[model samples]
Target: MLSIILLAVALSIDACIVAFSYSLTLNKNLIKNAFIFSFSSAFFQAFMPIVGFFIMYYFGLKFIELAKKIDHFIVFFIFLFLGIKIIKDAFKNETIQIEKNLSFKIVFSLSVATSLDALAAGVLIFSSKLDILDCIFIIFVITFVLCFMSFCIAKSIKLNIKLLQIISAIIIILIGFKILIEHTIKHI
Candidate 1:
Protein backbone atom coordinates (compact mmCIF):
# COMPACT_ATOMS: atom_id res chain seq x y z
CA MET A 1 0.00 0.00 0.00
CA LEU A 2 2.78 2.39 0.91
CA SER A 3 4.71 1.43 -2.18
CA ILE A 4 1.66 2.02 -4.34
CA ILE A 5 1.12 5.41 -2.79
CA LEU A 6 4.74 6.37 -3.29
CA LEU A 7 4.69 5.29 -6.90
CA ALA A 8 1.47 7.26 -7.36
CA VAL A 9 3.22 10.37 -6.09
CA ALA A 10 6.20 9.84 -8.36
CA LEU A 11 4.05 9.18 -11.39
CA SER A 12 1.85 12.20 -10.72
CA ILE A 13 4.73 14.66 -10.60
CA ASP A 14 4.62 15.25 -14.31
CA ALA A 15 0.95 16.14 -14.20
CA CYS A 16 1.53 18.46 -11.29
CA ILE A 17 4.31 20.19 -13.15
CA VAL A 18 2.15 20.60 -16.20
CA ALA A 19 -0.70 22.05 -14.18
CA PHE A 20 1.66 24.39 -12.40
CA SER A 21 3.31 25.51 -15.60
CA TYR A 22 0.02 26.06 -17.37
CA SER A 23 -1.47 27.87 -14.45
CA LEU A 24 1.48 30.22 -14.38
CA THR A 25 0.59 31.41 -17.86
CA LEU A 26 -3.19 31.39 -17.64
CA ASN A 27 -4.78 34.69 -16.66
CA LYS A 28 -8.45 34.21 -17.52
CA ASN A 29 -10.78 31.28 -16.97
CA LEU A 30 -8.43 29.96 -14.34
CA ILE A 31 -10.98 27.63 -12.78
CA LYS A 32 -12.18 26.19 -16.06
CA ASN A 33 -8.72 25.74 -17.55
CA ALA A 34 -7.36 24.18 -14.39
CA PHE A 35 -10.21 21.71 -14.14
CA ILE A 36 -9.90 20.64 -17.77
CA PHE A 37 -6.16 20.10 -17.62
CA SER A 38 -6.26 18.41 -14.24
CA PHE A 39 -8.94 15.97 -15.30
CA SER A 40 -7.22 15.28 -18.61
CA SER A 41 -3.85 14.72 -16.96
CA ALA A 42 -5.34 12.46 -14.32
CA PHE A 43 -7.31 10.43 -16.83
CA PHE A 44 -4.30 9.74 -19.04
CA GLN A 45 -2.02 9.07 -16.12
CA ALA A 46 -4.47 6.47 -14.84
CA PHE A 47 -5.37 4.97 -18.19
CA MET A 48 -1.90 4.54 -19.73
CA PRO A 49 -0.74 2.25 -16.93
CA ILE A 50 -3.62 -0.13 -17.57
CA VAL A 51 -2.63 -0.21 -21.22
CA GLY A 52 0.98 -0.89 -20.27
CA PHE A 53 -0.02 -3.44 -17.69
CA PHE A 54 -2.22 -5.41 -20.09
CA ILE A 55 0.47 -5.25 -22.74
CA MET A 56 2.98 -6.62 -20.28
CA TYR A 57 0.55 -8.99 -18.60
CA TYR A 58 -0.21 -10.84 -21.80
CA PHE A 59 3.27 -10.79 -23.35
CA GLY A 60 5.21 -10.93 -20.14
CA LEU A 61 3.34 -13.98 -18.87
CA LYS A 62 5.25 -16.15 -21.26
CA PHE A 63 8.44 -14.94 -19.64
CA ILE A 64 7.17 -15.30 -16.09
CA GLU A 65 9.59 -17.94 -14.94
CA LEU A 66 12.56 -16.20 -16.47
CA ALA A 67 11.33 -12.80 -15.35
CA LYS A 68 11.05 -13.82 -11.71
CA LYS A 69 14.76 -14.42 -11.58
CA ILE A 70 15.51 -10.79 -12.53
CA ASP A 71 12.26 -8.93 -11.92
CA HIS A 72 13.93 -6.76 -9.30
CA PHE A 73 16.60 -5.70 -11.74
CA ILE A 74 13.99 -4.87 -14.35
CA VAL A 75 11.94 -2.77 -11.97
CA PHE A 76 15.01 -1.03 -10.65
CA PHE A 77 16.31 -0.29 -14.11
CA ILE A 78 12.96 1.07 -15.26
CA PHE A 79 12.74 3.42 -12.32
CA LEU A 80 16.39 4.41 -12.39
CA PHE A 81 16.18 5.21 -16.06
CA LEU A 82 12.97 7.15 -15.52
CA GLY A 83 14.53 9.10 -12.68
CA ILE A 84 17.59 9.92 -14.76
CA LYS A 85 15.43 10.94 -17.67
CA ILE A 86 13.43 13.33 -15.50
CA ILE A 87 16.63 15.00 -14.32
CA LYS A 88 18.01 15.09 -17.83
CA ASP A 89 14.84 16.60 -19.24
CA ALA A 90 14.86 19.24 -16.56
CA PHE A 91 18.25 20.43 -17.73
CA LYS A 92 17.28 20.69 -21.39
CA ASN A 93 16.77 24.13 -22.89
CA GLU A 94 13.53 23.28 -24.59
CA THR A 95 10.28 24.34 -22.94
CA ILE A 96 6.69 23.69 -23.91
CA GLN A 97 5.10 26.81 -25.39
CA ILE A 98 1.33 26.86 -25.26
CA GLU A 99 -1.01 29.45 -26.69
CA LYS A 100 -2.97 31.43 -24.14
CA ASN A 101 -6.02 30.07 -25.83
CA LEU A 102 -5.90 26.59 -24.38
CA SER A 103 -7.27 24.15 -26.89
CA PHE A 104 -8.39 20.52 -26.61
CA LYS A 105 -5.54 19.39 -28.86
CA ILE A 106 -2.90 21.02 -26.70
CA VAL A 107 -4.36 19.64 -23.49
CA PHE A 108 -4.56 16.14 -24.89
CA SER A 109 -1.02 16.25 -26.21
CA LEU A 110 0.42 17.45 -22.93
CA SER A 111 -1.50 14.85 -20.97
CA VAL A 112 -0.34 12.04 -23.22
CA ALA A 113 3.22 13.26 -23.37
CA THR A 114 3.54 13.62 -19.61
CA SER A 115 2.00 10.24 -18.88
CA LEU A 116 4.32 8.20 -21.07
CA ASP A 117 6.47 7.26 -18.10
CA ALA A 118 3.45 5.78 -16.38
CA LEU A 119 3.12 3.40 -19.29
CA ALA A 120 6.56 1.99 -18.61
CA ALA A 121 5.73 1.94 -14.94
CA GLY A 122 2.72 -0.23 -15.65
CA VAL A 123 5.13 -2.99 -16.44
CA LEU A 124 6.13 -3.00 -12.80
CA ILE A 125 2.55 -3.64 -11.70
CA PHE A 126 3.01 -7.28 -12.71
CA SER A 127 5.71 -7.62 -10.08
CA SER A 128 3.67 -6.05 -7.30
CA LYS A 129 1.21 -7.95 -5.11
CA LEU A 130 -1.43 -5.23 -5.19
CA ASP A 131 -4.56 -5.34 -7.33
CA ILE A 132 -4.52 -3.39 -10.59
CA LEU A 133 -7.80 -1.65 -9.77
CA ASP A 134 -6.40 -0.45 -6.49
CA CYS A 135 -3.37 0.90 -8.25
CA ILE A 136 -5.52 2.66 -10.80
CA PHE A 137 -7.77 4.30 -8.24
CA ILE A 138 -4.85 5.41 -6.12
CA ILE A 139 -3.05 6.82 -9.13
CA PHE A 140 -6.11 8.64 -10.41
CA VAL A 141 -6.93 10.24 -7.09
CA ILE A 142 -3.38 11.26 -6.31
CA THR A 143 -2.76 12.75 -9.74
CA PHE A 144 -5.99 14.74 -9.76
CA VAL A 145 -5.39 16.06 -6.29
CA LEU A 146 -1.80 16.99 -6.94
CA CYS A 147 -2.48 18.62 -10.27
CA PHE A 148 -5.39 20.62 -8.91
CA MET A 149 -3.25 21.70 -6.01
CA SER A 150 -0.48 22.67 -8.36
CA PHE A 151 -2.88 24.95 -10.17
CA CYS A 152 -3.96 26.52 -6.90
CA ILE A 153 -0.36 26.93 -5.77
CA ALA A 154 0.78 28.47 -9.02
CA LYS A 155 -1.81 31.16 -8.67
CA SER A 156 -0.11 32.37 -5.53
CA ILE A 157 3.61 31.95 -6.18
CA LYS A 158 6.16 31.25 -8.86
CA LEU A 159 7.82 27.87 -8.44
CA ASN A 160 11.30 26.60 -9.19
CA ILE A 161 10.34 23.83 -11.61
CA LYS A 162 13.83 22.43 -12.10
CA LEU A 163 14.23 22.03 -8.38
CA LEU A 164 10.90 20.21 -8.15
CA GLN A 165 11.88 17.86 -10.97
CA ILE A 166 15.18 17.06 -9.31
CA ILE A 167 13.40 16.30 -6.06
CA SER A 168 10.92 14.06 -7.82
CA ALA A 169 13.79 12.28 -9.55
CA ILE A 170 15.44 11.61 -6.22
CA ILE A 171 12.24 10.17 -4.81
CA ILE A 172 11.85 7.87 -7.81
CA ILE A 173 15.43 6.66 -7.59
CA LEU A 174 14.99 6.02 -3.90
CA ILE A 175 11.84 4.02 -4.53
CA GLY A 176 13.77 1.92 -7.01
CA PHE A 177 16.44 1.29 -4.41
CA LYS A 178 13.78 0.40 -1.88
CA ILE A 179 12.27 -2.19 -4.17
CA LEU A 180 15.68 -3.63 -4.98
CA ILE A 181 16.61 -3.94 -1.34
CA GLU A 182 13.28 -5.51 -0.41
CA HIS A 183 13.54 -8.06 -3.18
CA THR A 184 17.10 -8.98 -2.30
CA ILE A 185 16.26 -9.46 1.35
CA LYS A 186 13.21 -11.53 0.51
CA HIS A 187 15.24 -13.80 -1.74
CA ILE A 188 18.01 -14.17 0.79
Candidate 2:
Protein backbone atom coordinates (compact mmCIF):
# COMPACT_ATOMS: atom_id res chain seq x y z
CA MET A 1 0.00 0.00 0.00
CA LEU A 2 2.77 2.45 0.87
CA SER A 3 4.65 1.63 -2.27
CA ILE A 4 1.52 2.08 -4.34
CA ILE A 5 0.93 5.50 -2.83
CA LEU A 6 4.51 6.53 -3.44
CA LEU A 7 4.34 5.46 -7.07
CA ALA A 8 1.09 7.34 -7.53
CA VAL A 9 2.59 10.54 -6.16
CA ALA A 10 5.58 10.20 -8.44
CA LEU A 11 3.35 9.72 -11.48
CA SER A 12 1.11 12.64 -10.52
CA ILE A 13 3.95 15.13 -10.37
CA ASP A 14 3.72 15.72 -14.11
CA ALA A 15 -0.01 16.24 -13.96
CA CYS A 16 0.46 18.73 -11.16
CA ILE A 17 2.80 20.78 -13.33
CA VAL A 18 0.33 20.73 -16.22
CA ALA A 19 -2.54 21.68 -13.98
CA PHE A 20 -0.50 24.57 -12.63
CA SER A 21 0.05 25.80 -16.19
CA TYR A 22 -3.67 25.63 -16.92
CA SER A 23 -4.44 27.48 -13.73
CA LEU A 24 -2.28 30.37 -14.83
CA THR A 25 -4.54 30.83 -17.84
CA LEU A 26 -7.73 30.57 -15.89
CA ASN A 27 -8.49 33.42 -13.51
CA LYS A 28 -12.16 33.25 -12.67
CA ASN A 29 -13.62 29.84 -11.96
CA LEU A 30 -10.10 28.45 -11.93
CA ILE A 31 -11.12 25.70 -9.59
CA LYS A 32 -13.78 24.43 -11.97
CA ASN A 33 -11.44 24.19 -14.92
CA ALA A 34 -8.76 22.73 -12.70
CA PHE A 35 -11.12 20.04 -11.53
CA ILE A 36 -12.02 19.17 -15.12
CA PHE A 37 -8.41 18.73 -16.15
CA SER A 38 -7.49 17.03 -12.90
CA PHE A 39 -10.30 14.51 -13.09
CA SER A 40 -9.63 13.71 -16.73
CA SER A 41 -5.93 13.27 -16.08
CA ALA A 42 -6.53 11.14 -13.03
CA PHE A 43 -9.05 9.02 -14.89
CA PHE A 44 -6.74 8.35 -17.83
CA GLN A 45 -3.78 7.68 -15.54
CA ALA A 46 -5.86 5.16 -13.61
CA PHE A 47 -7.62 3.63 -16.59
CA MET A 48 -4.60 2.95 -18.80
CA PRO A 49 -2.73 0.82 -16.26
CA ILE A 50 -5.71 -1.34 -15.48
CA VAL A 51 -6.21 -1.88 -19.17
CA GLY A 52 -2.52 -2.72 -19.57
CA PHE A 53 -2.62 -5.09 -16.62
CA PHE A 54 -5.64 -7.00 -17.85
CA ILE A 55 -4.25 -7.29 -21.32
CA MET A 56 -0.94 -8.54 -19.98
CA TYR A 57 -2.52 -10.92 -17.49
CA TYR A 58 -4.95 -12.46 -19.93
CA PHE A 59 -3.08 -12.42 -23.23
CA GLY A 60 0.70 -12.66 -22.91
CA LEU A 61 3.79 -10.77 -21.85
CA LYS A 62 4.97 -10.21 -25.43
CA PHE A 63 2.60 -7.28 -26.05
CA ILE A 64 3.47 -5.60 -22.78
CA GLU A 65 7.17 -5.97 -23.51
CA LEU A 66 6.77 -4.43 -26.94
CA ALA A 67 4.63 -1.59 -25.57
CA LYS A 68 7.18 -0.65 -22.92
CA LYS A 69 9.73 0.47 -25.49
CA ILE A 70 7.18 2.40 -27.52
CA ASP A 71 5.84 4.14 -24.48
CA HIS A 72 9.29 5.30 -23.40
CA PHE A 73 10.11 6.66 -26.85
CA ILE A 74 6.80 8.44 -27.23
CA VAL A 75 7.07 10.15 -23.85
CA PHE A 76 10.66 11.20 -24.45
CA PHE A 77 9.85 12.68 -27.85
CA ILE A 78 6.72 14.44 -26.72
CA PHE A 79 8.45 16.09 -23.78
CA LEU A 80 11.38 17.07 -25.94
CA PHE A 81 9.06 18.78 -28.37
CA LEU A 82 7.17 20.57 -25.65
CA GLY A 83 10.37 21.71 -23.97
CA ILE A 84 11.72 23.14 -27.21
CA LYS A 85 8.48 24.92 -27.94
CA ILE A 86 8.39 26.47 -24.49
CA ILE A 87 11.99 27.57 -24.73
CA LYS A 88 11.34 29.14 -28.12
CA ASP A 89 8.27 30.91 -26.85
CA ALA A 90 10.24 32.23 -23.90
CA PHE A 91 12.73 33.88 -26.18
CA LYS A 92 10.07 35.28 -28.53
CA ASN A 93 8.55 37.22 -25.63
CA GLU A 94 5.09 36.24 -26.76
CA THR A 95 3.12 36.36 -23.58
CA ILE A 96 -0.25 34.71 -23.31
CA GLN A 97 -2.47 36.28 -20.72
CA ILE A 98 -4.63 33.60 -19.24
CA GLU A 99 -8.30 34.24 -19.71
CA LYS A 100 -10.91 34.01 -17.00
CA ASN A 101 -12.61 30.94 -18.43
CA LEU A 102 -11.35 28.02 -20.50
CA SER A 103 -13.17 26.33 -23.33
CA PHE A 104 -14.09 22.67 -23.01
CA LYS A 105 -12.10 21.76 -26.08
CA ILE A 106 -8.99 23.48 -24.78
CA VAL A 107 -9.30 21.84 -21.40
CA PHE A 108 -9.79 18.42 -22.94
CA SER A 109 -6.81 18.83 -25.24
CA LEU A 110 -4.56 20.01 -22.43
CA SER A 111 -5.63 17.12 -20.26
CA VAL A 112 -4.70 14.66 -22.98
CA ALA A 113 -1.35 16.29 -23.65
CA THR A 114 -0.36 16.40 -20.01
CA SER A 115 -1.43 12.85 -19.29
CA LEU A 116 0.49 11.23 -22.15
CA ASP A 117 3.37 10.47 -19.80
CA ALA A 118 0.96 8.77 -17.47
CA LEU A 119 0.04 6.39 -20.25
CA ALA A 120 3.62 5.22 -20.37
CA ALA A 121 3.66 4.97 -16.61
CA GLY A 122 0.62 2.74 -16.85
CA VAL A 123 2.51 0.30 -19.04
CA LEU A 124 5.45 0.33 -16.64
CA ILE A 125 3.14 -0.37 -13.71
CA PHE A 126 1.56 -3.25 -15.53
CA SER A 127 4.95 -4.82 -16.12
CA SER A 128 5.88 -4.49 -12.45
CA LYS A 129 5.01 -6.90 -9.62
CA LEU A 130 2.37 -4.68 -8.02
CA ASP A 131 -1.33 -5.29 -7.47
CA ILE A 132 -2.90 -3.71 -10.54
CA LEU A 133 -6.25 -2.53 -9.24
CA ASP A 134 -4.90 -1.12 -6.03
CA CYS A 135 -2.08 0.64 -7.82
CA ILE A 136 -4.48 2.23 -10.29
CA PHE A 137 -6.79 3.45 -7.57
CA ILE A 138 -3.91 4.92 -5.60
CA ILE A 139 -2.56 6.66 -8.67
CA PHE A 140 -5.92 8.19 -9.47
CA VAL A 141 -6.37 9.50 -5.97
CA ILE A 142 -2.89 10.97 -5.73
CA THR A 143 -3.04 12.62 -9.15
CA PHE A 144 -6.39 14.24 -8.49
CA VAL A 145 -5.36 15.58 -5.09
CA LEU A 146 -2.00 16.87 -6.26
CA CYS A 147 -3.54 18.50 -9.34
CA PHE A 148 -6.04 20.31 -7.16
CA MET A 149 -3.29 21.55 -4.87
CA SER A 150 -1.21 22.81 -7.79
CA PHE A 151 -4.20 24.74 -9.11
CA CYS A 152 -4.66 26.43 -5.77
CA ILE A 153 -1.00 27.38 -5.64
CA ALA A 154 -1.06 28.76 -9.17
CA LYS A 155 -4.01 30.92 -8.34
CA SER A 156 -2.22 32.35 -5.34
CA ILE A 157 1.02 33.16 -7.13
CA LYS A 158 1.75 36.36 -9.06
CA LEU A 159 4.79 35.24 -11.00
CA ASN A 160 5.51 35.64 -14.70
CA ILE A 161 3.29 33.19 -16.54
CA LYS A 162 5.78 32.48 -19.29
CA LEU A 163 8.52 31.64 -16.82
CA LEU A 164 6.20 29.31 -14.96
CA GLN A 165 5.35 27.52 -18.19
CA ILE A 166 8.98 27.15 -19.15
CA ILE A 167 9.81 25.70 -15.77
CA SER A 168 7.00 23.19 -16.12
CA ALA A 169 8.25 22.23 -19.55
CA ILE A 170 11.76 21.71 -18.22
CA ILE A 171 10.53 19.50 -15.43
CA ILE A 172 8.56 17.36 -17.88
CA ILE A 173 11.50 17.05 -20.20
CA LEU A 174 13.76 15.95 -17.39
CA ILE A 175 11.28 13.32 -16.28
CA GLY A 176 11.05 12.08 -19.86
CA PHE A 177 14.78 11.74 -20.06
CA LYS A 178 14.82 9.89 -16.78
CA ILE A 179 12.19 7.47 -18.02
CA LEU A 180 14.07 6.85 -21.25
CA ILE A 181 17.31 6.14 -19.41
CA GLU A 182 15.63 3.84 -16.89
CA HIS A 183 13.90 1.80 -19.58
CA THR A 184 16.98 1.60 -21.74
CA ILE A 185 19.04 0.33 -18.84
CA LYS A 186 16.41 -2.25 -17.94
CA HIS A 187 16.25 -3.56 -21.50
CA ILE A 188 20.01 -3.65 -21.91
Candidate 3:
Protein backbone atom coordinates (compact mmCIF):
# COMPACT_ATOMS: atom_id res chain seq x y z
CA MET A 1 0.00 0.00 0.00
CA LEU A 2 2.81 2.37 0.90
CA SER A 3 4.68 1.48 -2.27
CA ILE A 4 1.56 1.94 -4.33
CA ILE A 5 0.95 5.37 -2.83
CA LEU A 6 4.53 6.35 -3.48
CA LEU A 7 4.37 5.24 -7.08
CA ALA A 8 1.09 7.08 -7.58
CA VAL A 9 2.54 10.31 -6.27
CA ALA A 10 5.65 9.88 -8.39
CA LEU A 11 3.60 9.30 -11.51
CA SER A 12 1.34 12.27 -10.75
CA ILE A 13 4.13 14.84 -10.88
CA ASP A 14 3.81 15.19 -14.64
CA ALA A 15 0.04 15.47 -14.45
CA CYS A 16 0.31 18.16 -11.83
CA ILE A 17 2.64 20.17 -14.03
CA VAL A 18 0.36 19.79 -17.01
CA ALA A 19 -2.66 20.77 -14.95
CA PHE A 20 -0.90 23.89 -13.80
CA SER A 21 -0.24 24.80 -17.41
CA TYR A 22 -3.86 24.27 -18.33
CA SER A 23 -4.96 26.48 -15.49
CA LEU A 24 -3.01 29.37 -16.91
CA THR A 25 -4.99 29.26 -20.13
CA LEU A 26 -8.31 28.86 -18.38
CA ASN A 27 -10.29 32.07 -17.79
CA LYS A 28 -13.77 31.02 -16.68
CA ASN A 29 -15.18 28.25 -14.51
CA LEU A 30 -11.61 27.35 -13.81
CA ILE A 31 -12.46 24.93 -11.06
CA LYS A 32 -14.97 23.01 -13.11
CA ASN A 33 -12.77 22.65 -16.13
CA ALA A 34 -9.78 21.82 -14.00
CA PHE A 35 -11.67 19.12 -12.16
CA ILE A 36 -12.88 17.60 -15.37
CA PHE A 37 -9.40 17.52 -16.82
CA SER A 38 -7.92 16.17 -13.62
CA PHE A 39 -10.56 13.51 -13.29
CA SER A 40 -10.02 12.28 -16.81
CA SER A 41 -6.27 12.19 -16.38
CA ALA A 42 -6.46 10.45 -13.02
CA PHE A 43 -8.96 7.89 -14.23
CA PHE A 44 -6.84 7.07 -17.24
CA GLN A 45 -3.73 6.79 -15.08
CA ALA A 46 -5.49 4.37 -12.77
CA PHE A 47 -7.22 2.45 -15.50
CA MET A 48 -4.17 1.93 -17.71
CA PRO A 49 -2.29 -0.01 -15.06
CA ILE A 50 -5.17 -2.39 -14.49
CA VAL A 51 -5.41 -2.90 -18.20
CA GLY A 52 -1.69 -3.51 -18.42
CA PHE A 53 -1.77 -5.89 -15.48
CA PHE A 54 -4.54 -7.90 -17.10
CA ILE A 55 -2.63 -7.99 -20.35
CA MET A 56 0.48 -9.25 -18.60
CA TYR A 57 -1.37 -11.72 -16.42
CA TYR A 58 -3.32 -13.20 -19.28
CA PHE A 59 -0.73 -12.96 -22.02
CA GLY A 60 2.94 -13.30 -21.07
CA LEU A 61 5.83 -11.61 -19.35
CA LYS A 62 7.74 -11.45 -22.60
CA PHE A 63 5.18 -9.11 -24.16
CA ILE A 64 5.23 -6.86 -21.13
CA GLU A 65 9.01 -6.70 -21.27
CA LEU A 66 8.92 -5.72 -24.91
CA ALA A 67 6.30 -3.07 -24.15
CA LYS A 68 8.42 -1.55 -21.41
CA LYS A 69 11.29 -1.10 -23.84
CA ILE A 70 9.27 0.92 -26.31
CA ASP A 71 7.05 2.77 -23.86
CA HIS A 72 9.67 5.26 -22.70
CA PHE A 73 10.84 6.21 -26.15
CA ILE A 74 7.30 6.43 -27.46
CA VAL A 75 6.20 8.74 -24.66
CA PHE A 76 9.34 10.85 -24.94
CA PHE A 77 8.98 11.35 -28.64
CA ILE A 78 5.29 12.15 -28.43
CA PHE A 79 5.78 14.75 -25.70
CA LEU A 80 8.79 16.26 -27.46
CA PHE A 81 6.89 16.54 -30.68
CA LEU A 82 3.80 17.95 -28.99
CA GLY A 83 5.87 20.48 -27.06
CA ILE A 84 7.55 21.64 -30.24
CA LYS A 85 4.18 21.92 -31.89
CA ILE A 86 2.77 23.96 -29.02
CA ILE A 87 5.74 26.28 -29.20
CA LYS A 88 5.20 26.73 -32.89
CA ASP A 89 1.50 27.32 -32.44
CA ALA A 90 2.21 29.92 -29.82
CA PHE A 91 4.40 31.84 -32.23
CA LYS A 92 1.91 31.99 -35.05
CA ASN A 93 0.59 35.42 -35.99
CA GLU A 94 -2.97 34.36 -35.25
CA THR A 95 -2.71 32.91 -31.82
CA ILE A 96 -5.39 30.33 -31.15
CA GLN A 97 -6.70 31.07 -27.72
CA ILE A 98 -8.51 28.50 -25.63
CA GLU A 99 -11.82 29.73 -24.32
CA LYS A 100 -12.93 29.64 -20.73
CA ASN A 101 -15.63 27.03 -21.48
CA LEU A 102 -14.33 23.48 -21.50
CA SER A 103 -15.09 21.09 -24.31
CA PHE A 104 -14.99 17.30 -24.31
CA LYS A 105 -12.55 17.18 -27.18
CA ILE A 106 -10.11 19.56 -25.52
CA VAL A 107 -10.36 17.88 -22.15
CA PHE A 108 -9.92 14.48 -23.72
CA SER A 109 -6.89 15.57 -25.69
CA LEU A 110 -5.24 17.14 -22.67
CA SER A 111 -5.98 14.11 -20.53
CA VAL A 112 -4.37 11.78 -23.01
CA ALA A 113 -1.35 14.01 -23.52
CA THR A 114 -0.56 14.54 -19.84
CA SER A 115 -1.31 11.05 -18.58
CA LEU A 116 0.66 9.24 -21.27
CA ASP A 117 3.59 8.80 -18.93
CA ALA A 118 1.31 7.09 -16.45
CA LEU A 119 0.37 4.58 -19.12
CA ALA A 120 4.02 3.70 -19.49
CA ALA A 121 4.42 3.47 -15.75
CA GLY A 122 1.45 1.10 -15.72
CA VAL A 123 3.45 -1.46 -17.65
CA LEU A 124 6.20 -1.30 -15.06
CA ILE A 125 3.79 -1.62 -12.16
CA PHE A 126 2.25 -4.71 -13.71
CA SER A 127 5.60 -6.40 -14.26
CA SER A 128 6.63 -5.68 -10.68
CA LYS A 129 3.70 -7.76 -9.41
CA LEU A 130 2.26 -4.90 -7.42
CA ASP A 131 -1.41 -4.81 -6.44
CA ILE A 132 -2.98 -3.19 -9.48
CA LEU A 133 -6.20 -2.10 -7.76
CA ASP A 134 -4.42 -0.35 -4.92
CA CYS A 135 -1.94 1.27 -7.29
CA ILE A 136 -4.70 2.50 -9.58
CA PHE A 137 -6.74 3.94 -6.75
CA ILE A 138 -3.70 5.67 -5.33
CA ILE A 139 -2.77 7.11 -8.68
CA PHE A 140 -6.31 8.34 -9.33
CA VAL A 141 -6.61 9.98 -5.94
CA ILE A 142 -3.18 11.55 -6.00
CA THR A 143 -3.46 12.96 -9.48
CA PHE A 144 -6.92 14.36 -8.83
CA VAL A 145 -5.87 16.09 -5.63
CA LEU A 146 -2.68 17.50 -7.09
CA CYS A 147 -4.33 18.67 -10.26
CA PHE A 148 -7.01 20.50 -8.31
CA MET A 149 -4.38 22.07 -6.12
CA SER A 150 -2.43 23.18 -9.15
CA PHE A 151 -5.55 24.69 -10.68
CA CYS A 152 -6.20 26.71 -7.53
CA ILE A 153 -2.66 27.91 -7.49
CA ALA A 154 -2.80 28.92 -11.09
CA LYS A 155 -6.02 30.79 -10.54
CA SER A 156 -4.46 32.69 -7.66
CA ILE A 157 -1.38 33.73 -9.58
CA LYS A 158 -1.35 36.90 -11.66
CA LEU A 159 1.03 36.09 -14.46
CA ASN A 160 1.16 36.45 -18.23
CA ILE A 161 -0.62 33.60 -19.95
CA LYS A 162 1.73 33.62 -22.92
CA LEU A 163 4.72 33.28 -20.65
CA LEU A 164 3.02 30.47 -18.84
CA GLN A 165 2.45 28.67 -22.13
CA ILE A 166 6.11 28.99 -23.07
CA ILE A 167 7.13 27.71 -19.66
CA SER A 168 4.75 24.80 -20.02
CA ALA A 169 6.24 23.88 -23.37
CA ILE A 170 9.74 23.96 -21.95
CA ILE A 171 8.75 21.85 -18.98
CA ILE A 172 7.20 19.20 -21.20
CA ILE A 173 10.20 19.12 -23.49
CA LEU A 174 12.51 18.72 -20.50
CA ILE A 175 10.43 15.83 -19.24
CA GLY A 176 10.68 14.19 -22.63
CA PHE A 177 14.44 14.58 -22.68
CA LYS A 178 14.68 13.25 -19.15
CA ILE A 179 12.70 10.17 -20.08
CA LEU A 180 14.85 9.62 -23.15
CA ILE A 181 18.07 9.94 -21.17
CA GLU A 182 16.83 7.65 -18.41
CA HIS A 183 15.87 4.94 -20.89
CA THR A 184 19.09 5.26 -22.88
CA ILE A 185 21.13 4.92 -19.71
CA LYS A 186 19.17 1.88 -18.68
CA HIS A 187 19.69 0.24 -22.04
CA ILE A 188 23.40 1.00 -22.20
Highest TM-score against the true fold, candidate: 3
Give me the runs in candidate 1 sitting further than 4 Å from their true place.
61-101, 158-188
Residue pairs of candidate 2 with colliding backbone atoms: none
Tens-place lDDT per residue, model 2, 31-149, is 67778778887887787777666766677677767776676777677667766665565567455644566667555654555555565455566677777777888888888999988
lDDT of 1 at 3: 85
True-structure RMSD, every candidate: 7.9, 3.8, 2.9
Per-candidate local distance difference test: 0.72, 0.71, 0.73
Estimate TM-scores for all models.
0.62, 0.72, 0.81
lDDT of 3 by residue, 28-141 (tens): 898788888889888877877776777766886776667667767776876787567667756765665645765686566557655655655667777777767768878899
Clash count list over all predictions? 0, 0, 0
Rank candidates by lDDT, best first: 3, 1, 2
Clashes of 3: 0
Number of the top lDDT candidate: 3
Model 2 gets an lDDT of: 0.71
Which ranges in model 3 have alpha carbons more than 4 Å from their true place? Answer: 94-98, 101-106, 113-131
Pitting candidate 1 against candidate 3, the one with the higher TM-score is 3
